[model samples]
Target: FSEVSWIPNKHYSGIYGLMKLTLTKALPSDLSKVIVLDTDITFATDIAELWGIFRKFTDKQVIGLVENQSDWYLGNLWKNHKPWPALGRGFNTGVILLYLERLRRIGWEQMWRLTAERELMSMLSTSLADQDIFNAFIKQNPVLVHQLPCFWNVQLSDHTRSEQCYTEVSDLKVIHWNSPKKLRVKNKHVEFFRNLYLTFLEYDGNLLRRELFGCPSQASPDSVQLQTALEELDEDDQCYDFRRERLTVHRVHLYFLQYEYTPTEDDTDITLVAQLSMDRLQMLEAICKHWEGPISLALYMSDAEAQQFLRYAQASEVLKNRKNVGYHIVYKEGQFYPVNLVRNVALKNANTPYVFLTDVDFLPMYGLYDYLRKSVVQLDMAHAKKALVVPAFETLRYRLSFPKSKAELLSMLDMGSLYTFRYHVWPKGHAPTNYAKWRTATTPYKVEWEPDFEPYVVVRRDCPEYDQRFVGFGWNKVSHIMELDAQEYDLMVLPNAFMIHMPHAPSFDISKFRSSSSYRNCLNTLKDEFHQDLSRKYGSAALKYLTAQRNM
Candidate 1:
């Protein structure tokens, strides 16, 4: 396929341009026929009508295509336009009805190859890949194509003469934006078409009806306890009201669309669950590069940010190629960061048995992916209720080469360049990891749960969901770890595994927590309610270790 030369243009010069030709071999043997539509085409009418058109095909017809709407093939669109060979008006490959079984029945592969080779000798280079060869082939053997009506694919290019097919927008079945300028393309009915496109973009899909088929998975008794506590709170309790409002609102998952990475059976055991806002998107490359396994990433953003993130991710050198990362966008709501809410989304969307919950800013120790896999098996975490903690450290410097090994990390720790996360500001944050013992220990060590202890860990997918009641800064992760303890899951530290925090400016919520007394006071109230709810559900044993819970 590479032997044939293509016109030097970014839009239509890749080998993927010819992928449509190889679909007969690419798809399964049992798949008989399929409709292939370009990403630029938007259906104005029901697609069922187009599928029914297949019944109109003759036994000799193996492909269905609409005639190209412009005079490019006739070399009349521009002063010196040189398009490849075609029969009269060439057929467009944008919207195709492929009869795979019939194509394989005939020697379609060998025939197209010969046609392409023969045409290339004269044309020297084809502007469009398979579209050129396809038209050239049909010019010789016209029986293979069943010409579709032009209305089925209303070509909307700058030079498109498709006005002959439709006098009104209602007559068009599909609108194909064949030009790079798309909405900016010069058309007689530009406003109508542009408005139509924008209307679809801003359409409210909630108008569609949906049905729940079965009972939802029941929440834990502790969840009900928390709800009861919130319900019984005074009307003036702002924190409880905030929690209730967030809990009642449904979270939007896969905001635009979802592309779940398919991992090998052996590699699907563990998924890294992390949450980030738009500002942290650039960190995805380093995270993906170090962690080769599957990742469940939750992005917190507004509607505009979601669109911006989609564009950035598409153009990113590292993010564009990663099939192992699953991006779930949680639309930003209200003032709070919704930190735990974002965490819950990532956790719930994860498909693997175990998930390593961490922040997107942290880079895992080089071998942590493989190390955790071995630890999960050796520790029998799949069957046992165990959470393997990956000790976290942070550097004050904004930029530094991350330590690749535990020995290097220990060396940096000794040098005072790296310290346990929040060591000076808040020692209790990760103090439970007992880093003093971790320095010499070579095996997993049991960690007794303490108040406000929130270390990143790899736990089972079925582990308790993050407390939605804890919305913002203070107790977001603290409440989650407290629940895990209440549920009686063992927190064990992996001796070798570590995560280094790439420091950044404080989050909006954290800044709010520090400056606003009301914010801290609200967090304290929410923390009290959360602990009380846990105690009521788990019978006071859960909160026994704390005579007093510290306020952040």
Candidate 2:
């Protein structure tokens, strides 16, 4: 104990937040090069599994808890801070994976001051002080920062590790959970604050009930007066108000856009019908280069990233309005393995009448919006509950894990589009030049009437909202598809209306997606309902697509 001489710090309003700043200034130059955090981060997953990753991620430099400040917190990306992984933003201050050399050169002291500025930001010190400060440094100086796998700072959030849900745990390198804050706030003992509340209850619980019972429970006027004094206590209590806590739950309005990106003006809010995300941004930009409406981005993100991005997205503008685009953050927090929540989150957050969803990565070489517009004119598109329509295309990269035969590859590059089904869904919003009518217009859509029919495919943010009771990982979505058969919605597949899925690979390959807990949970959750529903909706529909195509 004498060799390490650590002091109990209590100099500022938020001493915990200032730990990073103090460490930056105090570590001896000759001390051990690496400074690992000994946080009592509650264990949620296998620490041993994460320990194995530290060795593999050795090439990576500097890691810590990822923070949500850069996205939505005012104090997080405060006027003085910068963006993440670039110019620096708020970072978790609890534990850091530091190359002390980098810290010294960047004037890490200055970075910490900007984040935890006890002397400068006494009022703002109560929030995101540690995490945001650490990240701010990394964003400001990217060359020094690297993301670690989940093992390091595992308990940063309150959710249990078993409850955690992320797209890939392999991507998580380190975990960080700063000291618990519920018991303490801004260097004040809040546990005692609650104790005071209890004390008030002890003094006046019976009397408080009497006030409503008409002055009968209180033994005397002093008792009634005591109740009044308690009521007024909140005004003077230093415990502070819970409702005023800057952030409680990260609120993100969800949406689904198919191919919704455009390289339009920064103010452009071109809205496309499908759910979209970064994977399809480039393709969307190409498909709807001229869209003048709002563009929806289908966002499927890591739970932590969801918090970070959602916060950032709220303040961001895509054509001016604050809520230009909604985020369908697909997963919940704390579970090392949960996938159903991913689909569930997307299912519930959709705000628009329609949602566009695709696994497209990068921009398309041709405009898909043009083909959709033509199809919409031909098919007579309906709204949310009426029909589900999509365009079909044959490209070298379209199908996941589908290998193109040499002859097919040589002749299939023709860019023209066509439709295998006659319904209208996503019409050309980006690059449309024409409109086409369905051949069987005025005909009644009857697939929904079939007892065996089911939803053709799962669309992110599609209606009737998922029945959450069916969740595990992937089970609920599959059930909804089965339920869709009984609901009477129409479905179709078109050729001319298609856009490239991008980074196309076989959908069945488990290895490509990363073997994380979320992925496993979803796969294991593929129960009877999921399979049957998918079989009715997509199995037959898919068979129809292949059978019909093979004959041609």
Candidate 3:
């Protein structure tokens, strides 16, 4: 309604965007919040109620969880197509959510003009369609997103898109018939899709266990049979079960602990354990020799930090045959890249099904991967978070980086070092597992990997994607890295364990060190002032520290 432009099949040339293209800009205005539901959608339930849901989140910025509801027959045409990285089974533009203020602040309108429009007609012929246009926004402002449930936009009658309606037909919130033709309930397609929901969410290898292989249902039951079994199980914190098949051959990774100080002879608990840094080589060698899980070393380093790492690796018996050890360094190169880049890189290179990212210095307190393995067993494959961050990845040294001598190093450790903003996650109710609430099958679960490391997380790689722009070596510019993060990958953070930046003891005050590091001294007086403004603007943003590094 702002302004109008005309095209052939589509008309949005002026203020608005092409109908085929959807939104003309990346974000909404600073003045108000807006929700744009696509014209193709048919709402079978009350999504109008969602506005109330939006009101509850006054401080947090967000976009609506889009349910890709493009028509079924038409969907088959594009099912193979990879559209917005916000990725669902497909792109259905029936419903969309937007935030105007952030959009204007980030120059989204200009970005849209630059990225979305190609000549006048090219806008009419873009590939991302409307959602791709929106994805550009979604990736950068993920925190501003709200992941709506799939039932909100039911694509009815795909392989099983409409499966949940059979059992919970009355519970349907939004039925989005986004198909190309005017879609309606024809055959009992909705009912079949509804019933099949239970099968998809809980599907495991139970059938394969029983069938031609002749394995017993007790030995391994089909998912449907397992569903009957789970009815007997209760949800208890301490209670968990494993697929019997997993009992056959199990591989475990051990996290070693800190070795800096020697505790008093009589004070057994307080004494610093002897150096495992020395044994790491031998221990890892043995683990790699037999166990297959990946073992990662998490250490904070700068261009200046000593390569005791290289020495440790050199000492490793496995390194004598480097192929077996599988050593890799994970970190971003740019000064503005966040500390999480290192973790992201390590996870990326990890090959085994079970990847262990542990501190080279300190190990977990209790000798345990058993309780965690049991926790893993209890996960609803469809509902489980793939990456598991444990209090396991830790060190003995506390805050050593903050030492006064490490001042310059501390400077480098400050915020806004990361080039891109984190991505939005798939809203919970929208996940395939929600079918279980209605006694339906769950869809296979996956987490999009757009790394945002504030509160800790450990995840299994489902769609283990990284913004390739940030990967390898690449020079970055404003919004470009964020643009890539926005276009590809979804990020989720789960509360759990964290990576301990092991210090020999709580000797250094890294934050003070950061304030006083070499980078600070080298910076011009202007940067010093700008640094203050930046800290205020981004609020402990990693980029400020990185920017100071860049300035240095």
TM-score for each candidate, following the candidate numbering? 0.66, 0.33, 0.26
* Model 3 error, position 358 (Å): 88
Which of the predicted structures, 1 or 3, would earn the higher lDDT when compared with the native?
A: 1
lDDT of each residue in 250-276, candidate 2, tens digit only: 233455222233343322111343334
Q: Rank the candidates by lDDT, best first.
A: 1, 2, 3
TM-score of 1: 0.66
Q: Per-residue error at 409 for model 2, in Å?
A: 11
For each candidate in the order shown, give its overall lDDT on alpha carbons.
0.81, 0.39, 0.37
Q: Indicate the worst ten consecutive residues by lDDT in candidate 2.
A: 239-248
Query: What's model 3's overall lDDT?
Result: 0.37
Q: Candidate 3, residues 442-471: lDDT per residue as tens digits?
A: 222333322213212233433333322221
The alpha-carbon RMSD values of the candidates against the true structure, listed in the order shown, are 8.5, 22.7, 30.3
What value does the lDDT take at residue 53 in candidate 3?
60
